[model samples]
Target: MPKMGFKKLFFFKPSPPPLSVSNNTFSDSLMEENIETARSVITECESQSPPLFTNTRQQAKQYLHAVITLQSTMQYLVERDSSSQKLVKAQFLMQIAMKRLQTEFYRILAENRDCLDPESVSGISSTDHQSSVSDYDDDFPEDDFQFAGDSFSTVAMADLKAIAECMVSAGYSKECVKIYILTRKSIVDEALYHLGVERFSFSQLQKMEWEVLETKIKYWLNAVRVATGTLFPGERALCDFIFGSPEKKIAESCFAEICREGAMSLFGFPENVAKCKKTSEKMFRTLDLYEAISDNWQHIESIFSFESTTSIRSQAVASQVRLGEAVRTMLMDFESAIQKESSKIPVPGGGIHPLTRYVMNYIAFLADYSNALADIVADWPKNPLPESYFQSPDRDGNNRSPEVVERFAWLILVLLCKLDAKAELYKDVALSYLFLANNMQYVVVKVRNSNLGFLLGDDWLTKHEAKVKEYVSKYERFGWSKVLALLPENPPAEMAMEQAKAIFQSFNAAVEETCRAQSSWVVSDPKLRDEIKVWIASKLVQRYWEYYEKYRGGLESVIRFSPDKLGNYLYEIVLFRAEESGSVSSHSASPPHRFKRS
Candidate 1:
């Protein structure tokens, strides 16, 4: 009953006309009319004559009004629940509006170019003129933001074409290039941000959104080229943005594309390689993250593993071709420089002719290649080989193949060589090569005997023991001298003792393991077992005597070789007991006194 008052009745009255009702139609019709008004303004601006207004203020006001009206219409469209068709229509209308505004402004500016010099423009006192110019400069085409759904295609295409024409007409190619690059950057940033928000996986992105992003990037790069006669500055930044951004999902998808097609090759850009190298160097500086660079390199290696039939094979071939070209260039320069040096000085061995030097250099190059191949094999992911995957071809290509097992052994040898080189003031490279003799033996055994059972049999074990003993003897002869020479001239006695102790411990472990394994054959064959026992005894005796000589009766005697001596002593004690009990011949015992009383 109280609601029957005038205040309550006011709510029942008809509402005032909406600002959109100027056309006196339904909401939809009113919207259509507003859109038409916007379209007309655009058409008028597009068709307007150059210098339509002699006054700078008038020209400024015209540019300002056009920009504001276009912006307002864009907002209206964005708020409306338009269908795909309507959205497309709205986008097209906005595109036309933008084109008209830009064309008229440029035309007017060109005509009044002499009058609107920077200094003269700066001297203008009207705040409205300054404000209008500011707004004009501030206005970015709504074509970037206004398009909805299917409308994006039509608007985007039209805007691109118009931008291309504008750049061509303005003769501001450099400025256009910069704008294009910045625009591309912005688009990429936006895409990456959205991708992060969506939390898409790499595979998901590749199947779903990769093409869309790629299309946008391609358009941007093309626009840059069309706008500018030269490539964008810091061209590598684009590569980094794609490959090294924190939006991992997008970057990973981009990586897949890059892997499928050599990204640099696809883009026809070497700047990407420079970018990779730079990023790799930065990663390398942080020891903890060095593996990141290695991971990327490994990824590169995986891409190179293409069969002859796959599409990626072509990209691999291209990468190799580029590498080969670079190597050829380097070799040419090296040979030329060496020839110059040889020409100036009478070299040893008949001046070591250029061809001979080249041959030697090529040999060295092969050695380096072998070393690098070994490293790559070592670092490859460890998984059981797929049934159909082909093995890597060896340098000789004689049915011999690269295998990680042998590569691991070679890596150990390389590490030993590096340690030796630094440990000794001057390393004998021959000794380093000898250190790898064990690895070479393993490789030979692997090649000749593919059966794992045969490789681990008695004959293989015997050969392994012999090879190890040979290396041990060689190490013993020169190791102490090398260690002493490498140490500071007056190193502390404790330091020397520590070094000697470590060496003895390592050698003792190797000898003891070999001896113990060899002893296991005792129950199988008497004659073969006796031979093995003797060999084991001889090694143990040699190592024991070496330890005693170094340590005398000290901490080294007590702690350094205790385990080795105990093992040898136990063996001797068993042999004596067997002889005394008539369980074995005295001939098995060299001499009881040979064992020092522990």
Candidate 2:
């Protein structure tokens, strides 16, 4: 994949810095008190006959609840004083509490295995229980917590200080790993609830207090460097807790920070680049998995549309179709805007600008892609058809209806004629029209079996021919020498141009005679008439500068010919003449004034 362009890449916005923590002895005392309370609870749980309570179920629930409450309180302290020594102390104490709870729960279950019946067991098996306990113990190795000295009084003060210092330094990572490990265990236990003691540690971690643990983990991972000096084994698991679990917002913040800070450089310590290679691979793998599952357009739409589950294949196809349609709509708007501008005159020249022509060609290409995608999406099997009996159509059977293709062809030709007559940007505009004609031919061929073919084959072709002849006749009678000269040559331009102008004049006379003879014709929809007027005015204004620039020669002549004329002659003629009453008396005469040409 190509790297994203710098212009398109969004920059990371930094968050406000965390509040300062006062390093007072009072703060330390408070932290010590919280740790002591937590320790007392853990010790009490450890000393119970079955380690916590008489009944395994009751003891499991009580111990689980106590761990949750203590964890919550510890989290509160951490958030309240994130950088304080007390907060560090509370984090370690929380880990000890979590460890004791897990140990007692495991010990009780193991001792009471005989009491456990198959009926009481849910998804839990002996293997699962052992795995959960083992993973938990791995996070907090026994040697890390054990006191080896025979007499506490005889222990050297220096040794005690060294141990405390190590604990403080290791506190954040240890607590994070334990939380990650125990959280996984709790999920298994919950899934195996009927087995006996369903741990609530997982449920407890879902609380807002979990953010404190996550923040500490993020800070530590971004600060420390071990021998290999990379994020530890459980780092991704903790990330999963933040992102994959229900606390999505927290995870988003964490992951966004990782991405922003350049996770590889966050720790800023001398370590092998290869140290983070595995962790980076794992992180990217997880991200890829998430994107695969979450970014499907069909899945996203289903969330809103109340649809039945679609097969993965169909979902993938629908996602592509949705994207194609979005691109088509955007391209269409761009084309329409350009077309509106191209209608305007170029400066000093009596035609459209060359840049406008370039834009139109690009827009035409976009339109072609849009139409192609639409056809592809339309023919994709919405309702499955058996393949064994299918046969591809031959040229005769595949040929589009002549009328439909002819109509589109004529429309393209008419647009070309108008563009060639009026636009200075002739080359690309001409090429674009040719491309449009070719694609329309393809569309006709593709949709031959559909109603679009019938329209192109008969109705469109007849209407197009009639409209062209009518416009030609009107142009001739109006003494538009340029229009007559510019008539297409392949079909005998001169003869057709003459007959067209006569027919146009006759049609205008007949329509006026009929309308004046009937009052009802004059009373037709006022709102519609107003809307038409507004639409014409908007188109004119949008193309005013372009048209004036392109057709400056002809426009200046018209302006000079009728100096007092309120609207440009071409504008009035194009917009109003076709719809005007035929009676010469009813027609508003052009201003008689004439001015010298510039």
Candidate 3:
């Protein structure tokens, strides 16, 4: 059942006087009558078949009234005549009332455990507590006890509060507080245990394997959410409501003592996990721990606000700090790993490098945690990148990316610099340029397609895309410069027939030699590959065709290629050609084929 609020039960200090008496100064007859009435009510409540506050709530109020009256009567007697038999008898009646009240208090807390559980009580809201003294007056019609409310939890909480007030007023707080702490503490402990939160020494964590530790970390991530989001808040609400108002200090003290050790154990686990060996592979788990604490920090501060429970809050903060340190260390180690790449073997066909794939994928995953990383590396020192490194204009103060963006961009820069060094392993200058283009394009695509695209922004992508074009331009210039340099500057300029035949023979040999050599060099991106092929064809085919038409009148014996043959050779540059589909007699040869841009 949903809970009802209990704010009305928390009464202020200097408790009101008994309903039967206006003041402490009572006449002898009035005092005797009050004492007799209190005795009779206590006697009947103790002997009643049903327990107090369950079926007979009206009688429960009568018992509470008698207890308060007996307490007042005893005080009045002590002030009037400390040695009189009346004072001693009133003290005896007060003892009986206190004993009866203690029994009911413990009984109500024990039997109403489910209704008074932290989860149920915390569900009670301020709006649900709008019922006033007049509202309860309408229900019971008893002016002496107006603590009753509309729901199961409301009635139970109201009864407990009344009993607690009477017991504390009668100097029986030790008994009342002891029962409360013991019962509630057990519930908190059991809930935590079922949630899989356990106390582990640093030695246990240190000795655990990564796989074992990772499982525990995953469980801790989920357990911390439940413990902070629901468990601790619920407990705090229950403690505050029951022992509230005049005895709020008692409530704080009780809660701190009960939950202090468990909370300390819970928040301290991440710190111990941080102390484990830092590896590039372990960084994500460490980051997960940091994010969990960061997400729940506000609740941690508010629920553990007591001075006595400050250590719980401190422990949570310490875990976040330690996890941050671990992440920073792992990131630095990852950068060093990138810089330390020493493999001499060039990628076959000038395709993407393995180092490039690994680092780009790693950085892309890191960008998924950009917000956490921004906080982690906020204070960590890093070298500033040069202004020329970025190609776009977003680097100004007004449009700068966050520290995480700068950090990620820097990591990609390191990978690119390492790739530049690796490119030197290729003896062919054109092939080295091809290798750089392939890897740089892979890195740019990885960033553009992932969360890195948002963190690094389009400006970063624009800068890198320009870099890919630079590498492609260099590859085309150096890889095909020899073939283009052999053609005449002016194809139609008058020249001797012998010189023209010599030029045609030399040009044909150079084109075949260049195409045969470049046939094996690879561009991994299909779009970029087709683009490079078409660009080479446009330059070479146009110039070669111009020279061929001008000199083809009587040089058929020397000319080995028509424009169509050259176009077919260009089509077969990067990959094998498809087989002819049918007999050649069905083909029309009217117009020569030419490579065109897509």
TM-scores of the candidates in the order shown: 0.24, 0.21, 0.80
Per-residue error for 15 in candidate 3, Å, reads 30
State in Å the error of residue 350, model 1. Answer: 12
Candidate 1, overall lDDT?
0.34
Clash statistics: count for each candidate: 0, 26, 0
lDDT of 1 by residue, 90-179 (tens): 456554544343344333333333332222222111111111123332233434332222333322322333333333332323332333
Runs in model 2 lying further than 4 Å from the true structure: 1-132, 135-358, 364-417, 423-598
Compose the digit string of candidate 2's lDDT tens values, residues 1-598. 0123211221122332333354556755555555566557656765655444332234434444445445555666767756655555555555555444334333333343333221122222112211111122212233432222222211111121222222223333333223323333333333233222212232342342433433433332223222012122122222332233223333333323322222222221112111222221122121222222224333233321212212323433443344334433443344344346333432221112233233323323222222233343343322221222112222355344333233233333334444544433424332233222222332333334344434334444344334434432332233222232232223232344445444334433443332232212111123323443354334333333332333334234232222212133323333322222222222222321121211
- Report the poorest 10 consecutive residues by lDDT, candidate 1: 589-598
Q: If candidate 2 were superposed on the true structure by all CA atoms, what would the RMSD be?
A: 26.2
Clashing pairs in 3: none
For 1-598, candidate 3 gives per-residue lDDT tens digits of 1112111222122322243323444476677777789878876765766777775566766677777777777787788767756655666667667666666776787777776666665554322333221122224534322222236666777677667777877788877787777777878887788777888998999898888888788778778888887777777766666666456787788889778887988999999999888887787778788888888888899889889898899899998999998898899999998888777777665767777767887788787678789788888665577767753234455433467777887888898899899899888898899889888888888898999887777777888889999998999899888878888557658879999899888888887777767676667677777777788887888888888888889999989889878876787543322212231123231221111211
Ten contiguous residues minimizing lDDT sum, candidate 2: 125-134
Best by TM-score: 3
